[model samples]
Target chain A: MENIHLENIDFEYAPGRRIFSGAAVDINQGELVLLCGKTGSGKSTLLRLIQKELDTKAGFVMQNPDNQIVCDRVYSELEFGATNATQGNERHRLELIRQRVAETAGYFGISRQINRDTHTLSGGEKQILNIASAMAANPKVLLMDEPTSMLDPIMADRVIDLVKNINRELGITVIIAEHRSDRIFAYADKILLIEDETVVCKDKRSMAEYMSRSQELRGFLPEIARSVEMSPPPLSLAEAVFGKAHAVYVGKEAPLSSHPVLRLKNVSFAYDRSKGALIDNLNLSVDGGSITALLGENGCGKSTLALLSAGALKPYSGSVKINGRKIKKAGENSAMLFQDVTLHFTGDTVDGKYNGMHPYDLSGGERQLAALDIILSKNPSLLILDEPTKGLDYNEKEKLGKRLEKLRDEGKAILLITHDVEFAAMFSDRMLLMFGGKIVCDRPAREFCESNIFYTTAGARLSKMNSD
Target chain B: MRRFENFNPATLLIYYMTVIIPIMVFMNPFIILTALAAGLVRAGIYERKIPVKRILFSAVLTAVMALVNGLLSHQGDTELFFINDRAVTLEAIRYGAVNGLMLAAAIVWFSAFSRTLTGEKIMALLWHLPKLALLISMIMRLIPRYLERYNKTGLAARINEERGQVPEKKHIMQITSAVFTWALENSMDTADSMIMRGYTSGGKRISGIQFRPGDAAVLALTAALQTMYFLPETWHGILMAVLCFLPEIYRIKENVKWKIYTLKI
Candidate 1:
């Protein structure tokens, strides 16, 4: 029997403001299921409900991971969950527990030889340790909510692969709710579409279904999904262009450049000299109306560049100008979609009319939409979005793309810093790929994705040549 | 909320002030109960900002924490009852209960008032104050929102770290840096947004918020509650409870209308 079931369930944050209504799904024992939805659609809340952690359940990774780890060192944190698991029975096999712990550590890339001191590890490493600790107890049902939204592509894949392995090996019933469908679709056996706080669609759908559908039958479509949905439902760019397709650039005077809206000249930034520069002498110029995507490997200087552009962090050297005015007030011009949607708000009130403060409190796609609201209010000449789609689902990415496109068309230059190559490739007019803190390459995002810098499940197959 | 045409903010200030400072400096339950009853009645009549779930949660949690602490910690002479060899002293336990209820009441009242004090209202009232102060106030006002977003990102980063997505090579250093950089950037973005909204243009500041007679009445009542502390302990307790309990009742009551705070958008 399933532990949780949603039978024609309808839930909304407010009455008549339906988030997910008519949501019906069943979670059988030991079943790995994926719940996908737009940011405001309530996938996370659903996971919480299923885990019976509505207030304290599934979604939260304990907001204060820094202080949450009470244990001093790394090994203790790793085995903390296992120790909790074996709280009483002295007879239960110590050897088996050790073996399990070691195996789990190996899977998560924890070294037995490493010191247990948590203070020694990096924040990402600490987070990895924290997550592994949670899995220590081996909760029969695991709810990973947008689990990899913050990771670089390679790291996200590693996590996805680990999750897939867990489902395959341990038979741990997994409920993974993620906004980005790039890594999740390949492993998901079933897709639960949550719309307006309701599960509207459930299917044993293939990535192909998502790949081929248009206008998002369930919710918002990823650009890959949208590009595929065009007549005959072309699956990739080549198909959209060459497979019964005419040049989209047909009958258009290619966009003319206005005055460079944001100019960065030989800008380089380094946290510490020994560590080297995150952005090394990067020169960039943006036309007044354009969608610019700054992409890089995880830990690369993409976000650093966003901070640089927004003037959040002073560059080690070089100059950044906004609208030909030297960048000032870093926090204002960069209405960044922080990888975590929760960090944007500055108040205690969860929901209200929120006044002008609402955008600052938005999460993921909602935050992106809120940024738009603030931008409209402020009439900013340039908008810098950092990791805009970090935790957004299929639909959210689509809405953001369309909105950013609209903003771009309206003459507001927008820079998107992201690790999701497909999002960069699909929505951006131009994409700049960063490697080891420098702009390794810059081209039209689609053209860039056509090269080796891209390789996600969607990226690999959703290319123009593949569709053709 | 939108349908209520005339909302009162003065009562909110008084209520918040009263919640923070006890209605009376005296220790008496009867007076507190009376004050609570009065607040309920007043709320029933005026129909101010509807108390939301968060306010209720804070009140309940405060009440529980207080009660639990009272039950566990206080050991004294007067015996009300005994549980597990420990005597529940009447005065000591009562002391805990009262403090707890006071806390709960305070949260409810303050939350209701807090909800009423919107950015628009503050801007309208303090527009004559230094423009920078008003702007600082707005930025400061968004502190809670930003804190929540920041915590959320940190936690999400935590989860990602566990999943093997956060690079194994760099550890948590980048996440912290990312979080810090992002927070700093958001403030700048908000500032930019404010500037973009023509905040720097020095346009004649226009405020849509207006005060009403009802608002004045709320203020008077709040001021009276605050003044009750000058009276005997009994009066203070009653006044405090009355002021504090209204928001709790408002939160529970549905489909009721009080003049909602309105601004011409």
Candidate 2:
């Protein structure tokens, strides 16, 4: 194993806009490194330089799965990296390439999807394909630019697992850029944080040592690690928050509305006829002045229900009443914020929020906030947000929770669909679970967190352990 | 997958090239009718249902072409009637009808061509041109995605509607600009990703287009039939026309016996 040692690296896009100045780091082979920074802190640029994709041998996996996929089919995408490595014999090249692609695809657990069209894959599958393609290249070093930034919690975990497997099983040096470090920090052997226009490199053993002095860096730590006051924080989140006291919310609960803003009665929907109805004879209602979270696993009809409630998709056989009126189409009084924030940003500059910078140039969290602002400007009675805190850091998620609280106080009916157990428990007043197209459980937020095991929050877990 | 989707691209291209030329060039009503029938038969076998609207549209176009020729061209000897000081000749109308039928037949055959040859199949045939193959497949994937995004943007606009009414002009403009920006940004990211994956690596990659024994047989059949098509005769041309539909006929028969011979996997 050979380590890549970068000494005094300097990079800049233009004059006066310094990205990295005299940045130096040594990345040992077969080690997992986490790169953390603010959105514009040149995290992607640093990764790009490390990969040297335009001029070197390092593999790169992009943040957006849809944008990263170049080939039309999965098999072709898997073959892309192995086929393009210019250093192979002409003899038996095709046979060698085929075997390499098949092996990588199988290892990535996407063997069945090889023949499937790349565009037809789900968000998570596409990200896995991106990583699989990178692995297919078989490079000594792999640089990922927030690979799990756009994935749901469940999907994000799968990507993290694959990355860990690549680091351990393949013994490839893995460097990942991520904003939310809760899931990834545990796997990282070292931490590379960009601050003060320099790369601060710390091994896993000394990361806590450094964090104790750098209060600003401590905020980037996982929720569990930030809460604990140990001199050297625990290695994993489970250790950091074990037997610790948890914060408790005791706000006076706002009463449910007498007249629901959005109502569904006997609603049933299915994308395909052969698959049967995913949402069958379901009844749900959302009223003003409270946040109601719709929680479920991936592909459990949460998004479909969100779409149906927003009137973007009409149920096959059911009544969707908005403000006590049966609507033929998506009502103007209802607004839906899609999971992809970029889908909603149209203005040049966050509408004077960013002093005329392009909306595309905004950070992920800023872009989400800007998009939500645009939707809110429409003054809709009911707001449906899908996975709002999916890839946001702890701070951004807290900011988002505050924004939701503000909206709820303004008497807006909020439907928050998310897989983040902690975020839902923090902000939502009521919780509902949609399993196999039916509302299996509906309870108050705190009560739901107390009862459920897997769907409960980190704070709940800590409190449970403390009690035990 | 369709019956001919997995057929070797080179063989499929050869078959289409051989069949389309006769449809385009030969003006005889029998040849044109047979070509049209063969195209429809093959497409029906592939799709399992004939596209009635497309066929009807072609018929309407043929009728319009014949009528236009009867009204516009007065060069023929046999006159049907005089309209606006111009002779509506029967010969001109018949000539126009045959020409129109030729055009329609060519269209139907080309539709069959498109059905048999996907962009990936084209890429497979041009495997040596890796960059071009990638571009073609990327475009093929991007188009449907662009349309889907466009529709979703429209949905977003509807969601921003006021009092159950669709958005005003300002909202529509916002939606359009947003979608355009997203498209542009997405394209740049896609290009970067492609480069990272070695799209511009200045070397060729092997396509996943395996040529089996059935493909070899089809290639041989196409080669033999193409020679017959180029021959200056009516019988050989007619034989080639029937051969054009051979794959579809074989497909139906093969499907019937598929379970008996092939394992379920």
lDDT of 2 by residue, A18-125 (tens): 898786788788989998876678888888887673333567888888988877889888877778763566657777788888889878899999889988999999
Per-residue lDDT for A150-216 in model 1, tens only? 6555666666677777778877667787554545554566677664455744444453465355345
What are the chain A TM-scores for all the models, listed individually?
0.75, 0.91
Model 1 backbone overlap count: 56
Give lDDT: candidate 2, residue A87: 57
Query: By lDDT, who's the top model here?
Result: 2
The residue ranges of model 2 lying beyond 4 angstroms of the native Cα positions read: A9-24, A53-55, A88-92, A209-219, A223-278, A311-331, A465-468, B1-7, B33-108, B127-131, B161-174, B199-234, B245-265
Instruction: Provide the DockQ value for model 1.
Output: 0.01
In candidate 2, residue A170 scores what lDDT?
A: 83
lDDT of 2 by residue, B1-265 (tens): 2366577788788878877786777676777878877776666656779878667877887898899988888988998889988899999998888888888888888887887787667778888887777778778778778888877877766676454343477766777777788889889988787777666657687766677888887777777766654666677647766577777766776886686556754
- DockQ per candidate: 0.01, 0.46
| Tens digits of per-residue lDDT for model 1, B149-244 | 555555433322223534644544554455555566555543432322223344222223456775675567666656775787666555666565
